[model samples]
Target: MTDFTEYAKALRARIDIALNQVIPETPNSQLAEAMRYSLASGGKRIRPLLLFAGYRATAGQQEHPALEIAACALEAIHAYSLIHDDLPAMDDDALRRGRPTCHLAFDEALAILAGDALQTLAFELLADTPGLTDSTRVQLIRSLSRAAGMRGMVVGQAIDLAAVDTELNITRLEHMHRCKTGALIDASVTMGALIGGASDQQLNILARYSRSLGLAFQVHDDILDVTADTATLGKQQGADLARNKPTYVSLLGLSSAQARAYELYQEALTALAELDGDTELLQRIAHYVIERRH
Candidate 1:
C-alpha cells in the first residue's frame, strides 16, 4: 500500500497534469485564455485529491476513467469558485496561493469570463469524460450540479457575502460552512464512491465520514487563517478579520474551534472504523489535515 504522503504527492501530480491537459491556451481564444489563467494559478488541489482518495478507498482511481475526469471537474468548479470569491465584488483579495488572484493577474472582465467558463467547463468535462458509460456520466453531472449549484456552494457563497456585515453565531456559522465548503467536500466523496461502484450501504457511511471531515477541514482552515503565516498559507492571514467575516474562531473562539475540529476529526475516524478501511493511511491523512500549517 502507498504511504499517505506518497499518495498525496502522486495525486497532486495527477491533478496538475489533468488541469494542464484540459485547460489550453489557443490562439485568438479569449475564453481559452481565461480558463488557462484561472486553472494555472495553482492551489493544493485538495478537493480533487479528496475525490481521488475516496475513489481509491473504494476502487482504485483507474477503475473508471470518468471518476478521474469527474474528480478533476470538482477541482475546476472549486477553482472557479475561488476565482470569483476573490473578485472585488466578492472577497476582493489581491493574493491567492501566494500569487495574484485571477482578477489581479488579469483584467476584471477577463477574470469574470474565466470564472464563468470554468464553471461551465466543469459540467462539460463531466458529461464527456472519456471512459464513462452514458448513465454514469449523467449521474456524475447530476451529482456535481447539486453540489456546486445554489443548494450547495453557490448558496454558501451568497450567505457568506451576506454575513460579511452581520455577525453570525455558532449555528449560522456552521450552516454557512456546511453550504459553502462541506457541500463540495461531501460531493467529492459521494461522486467517487458512486463511480467506484461502492455498495449503497458503504456509500452511506462514507457520506457521513465526508460530512464530518468537511466541517473539520473548514475549522482547521479557519484556525490556520489566524495562526499560520502568509508564506505557509499562500494567502494573507487575517483576511477573514479584515473582511469582518464571521468564522469559527470569531464565533467560538480559538480554543473552542480547535476542540470542535478535534471532535469532528474523531467522529470522522469513528465512522471509518465501521468500514473495512486501510486505517493507517486515512489516519495519517486525518492527522495531516488538522495539523497542516497551510
Candidate 2:
C-alpha cells in the first residue's frame, strides 16, 4: 500500500528543518522566542505539503532552492494567522496544537509582536529567496501578499468577527470561508505552480482544483469542530458554537455538511483530471484533506 503518511512525515521533517533555518531560535530576543514557539508547535503542515505537491505535479520532482523558502514562508504566514486568531481580540482560543496558545503562553503584546514579525518575515523570505528570477520573486510576493492581506484573509476575518450570532446563507458562508481560509490555500497551490513554471492553462485548472479543495478543507473543519473532542482536535472543540459562529454544520446540519465536503472533494478531483502531470500525490492530498482526523 502507498503510505502517504510516510511521505507526509518525511516531507514535514524537511519542512521543519527549513523553517528552523529561516528563523533561528534566539535566546536573546523574547519576541523571537514567542515566534518560534508557535512556528514549531506542530500542526499538519498541510499548506506546505500542498505547495510541494503542486510543484512536483507540475515541474516533476526537480529540486529548487526557492521551493523550500517558499514553503517556509507559507507556513510562517499560517503560523502568524494562528497567533493572531488566538489573541483575546480574535477567537480568544487558549489552546492550539495541544499547547497553550501564544497569548496564553506569552504576554498578549509579545504574541502580537510575534505575529507581526512572522507576517513580515514571510514577505522578506519571498522577496529575497534565491533561485528565482526577479519577475518570479515579484509574482510570488504579490500572490502571497494578496492572499494574506486585506483582499483575502484579513477581510475574511473581519467578516467573521461581524458575523457572530447572525444567520448566513450557504453562498455567503462559502464566500467568507473562501476569503478567510481558501485564499491562502489557493495561493499555496498557485504559488507552487508558478514556481514550477506551470502554463496558463495549468494554472487555471489548478486554481479550480484548489478552490474546491480549500472549501472542502474548511467544511471538514466545521464538521470536526462539532463532532471531535478537544483532546483529539488539539484545541477546544465546539469553539465555534460557543462563539455563536455559523458553521456549515450549524447551518446545514452534520450530515449535510459531511455531504458538502464529499461534493467539494469530487469537484477538486474533477479539476485535477484536466492537468497533465504526476498528480497522484495531489489526488491523495485532496482525499486526505477531507478525511483527516485532526
Candidate 3:
C-alpha cells in the first residue's frame, strides 16, 4: 500500500515539474520572468493536487493521462490570479512565498501582461491536453472559465475590494467569499471530477464537498492571517487588520472563526461521505487545509 503523504509528495513534484515545462524561460521575455517569479514561488500546490486526488477518489484511475495537464492548467489559473491580486491597484502585496511579488519582482506593466498571458495559456493547455474526449475537454474548459470569470472569483474579488472599510454582515461576507475564494477552489475539485469522467451525480456531490472545503479553507486562512508568522506565510501578517478588511476574525473574533472553520470542515467531510468513495486523500487534504501553519 502506498503512503498517501508520499503519494501526494510525488504527485506535487510531478505537477511542479510539468508546470515549469509548460512555459520555459525565454530571454527578452520579461513576461516569462514575471510569470516564473510567481509560479515558482513554491507554495503548496493544493489546488492541482486536489484535482488529481479528487479524480482518484471518484472516477477513473489516479493520475489519468490527462491528470498532469488538468493539474497544470489549474495551477496556471491560480498563479495568474495571484499575480493580479498582488498588483498595486489590487491587494498591493509586496511579498509572496517569502519574496517580492510579481509586480514587485518585475515592472507592473509586465506583471499585468504576464497575468494576461498566463490566463490564456491555461485555457490553451487545457484545450490541447491529449487523450481526453471532446466532450470532457469542452466541459473542463467551460467549467474553468465560469469559475474564474465575472460570476465567480472575479466577482468575489470585486466584492472584497468594494467591501473594504465598509461593514459586511456574515451573510454578505460568505456570499462574497463563495464567489471569490470558494469559486476557484470548487472549480479545482470540479475540474478534477470532470476530467476523471465522473457522473453528474458524483460531480454534484463533489461540488458540495468542494464548496464546504473552500469556505473552510478561507476561514482558516483568515485565522492564519493573525496566527501565522509573516515569514512562514510569505506575506504580511495582520494584513486584514491593517487594511480594515472584513474577515471571519474581524467579524466573529478568533475563537468564533476557529469554530466556523471546524464546522465547515465537518460539512465538507459529510459531503465527501455523501459521494461514498475512498476518502482517505480528501480527508487528509481537508485536515491539511485547516491545520496548515502557513
Best by TM-score: 2
Candidates ranked, most accurate by TM-score first: 2, 3, 1
Clashes of 2: 0
Ranking by lDDT: 2, 3, 1
lDDT of each: 0.81, 0.92, 0.86
Give a tens-digit lDDT track for model 2, residues 1-294: 158999999889999888777775556589888988898888898898889888987999786778889999999999999999899999999999999999999899999989998999999999988888999999899999999989889999999999999998999999999999999999999999999999999999999999999999999999999888999999999999999999999999999999999999999999998999978888999999999998
Q: Model 3, 209-260: lDDT tens per residue?
A: 8899999999999999999989889899998889999999999999999999
Q: Give each model's clash number.
A: 1, 0, 0
Give the better candidate number (1 or 3) by TM-score. 3
Which residue pairs overlap in candidate 3's backbone? none
Candidate 2 residue 222 Cα shift, in angstroms, is 0.4
Q: Which candidate is the best by lDDT?
A: 2
State the lDDT of candidate 1 residue by residue for 183-268, as single tens digits: 99888877877777778787888888888888999999999999998888888889998988999998899999999999999988
**How far off is model 1, as Cα RMSD?**
1.8
> Model 2: runs farther than 4 Å from truth?
24-28
